[model samples]
Target: MDGFDRFRAPPPDMLVMRPLDSMVAIFHRPSGRTHVVASPVPEILESLGPDPTDVATLLARLSERFDLAAGDREALLARLGELEAAGLVERL
Candidate 1:
């Protein structure tokens, strides 16, 4: 897969979350670190479900849940890269 076409969220049990006003506090069990995130970060993780997915499929899943602009592709990719770096998402 090219350009981040294969990715997945960590298992559901690996994460614990708390809503903090406009942001979210995420406890990543494996990393033993808490990450504060906003907007598409959590949404991306949720949309990833329990399976690895390509970028197109992931975008379709997200679109089903939110009004994603056509131009948001780059932003989506950037966010996925960020999540991957943070260990919140995994590359396959």
Candidate 2:
């Protein structure tokens, strides 16, 4: 997908996540498994929630929190995609 396409969020019921001090804990209740991943920046963890956040919103928040350059933003998003693909986090 192109960069613009990457900005799209996944559907709800795909995953759930909770942020801790230096990491984000993702739970896949349906599969009865969890993943604990260290965030690149602690601020990113703070921006996540039980509520839904679209990819654009997430990137925007990250930019504001970390002042990340475009490349950094894309890289961080790639990591998030990996987590999502693992079913650790859902689109909702």
Q: Tens digits of per-residue lDDT for model 2 on 4-32? A: 43322323354466777767776656776
Per-model TM values vs. the true structure:
0.92, 0.54
Candidate 1 per-residue lDDT, tens place, 11-66, comes to 88999988999999999999899999998788998999669898889989889999
Give Cα distance to truth, residue 35, candidate 1, Å: 0.2
lDDT for each of the candidates?
0.87, 0.57
The superposed Cα distance between candidate 2 and the true structure at residue 8, in angstroms, equals 8.1
Best by TM-score: 1
Q: Which ten residues in a row have the lowest lDDT in candidate 1?
A: 1-10
Number of clashes in every candidate structure? Answer: 0, 4
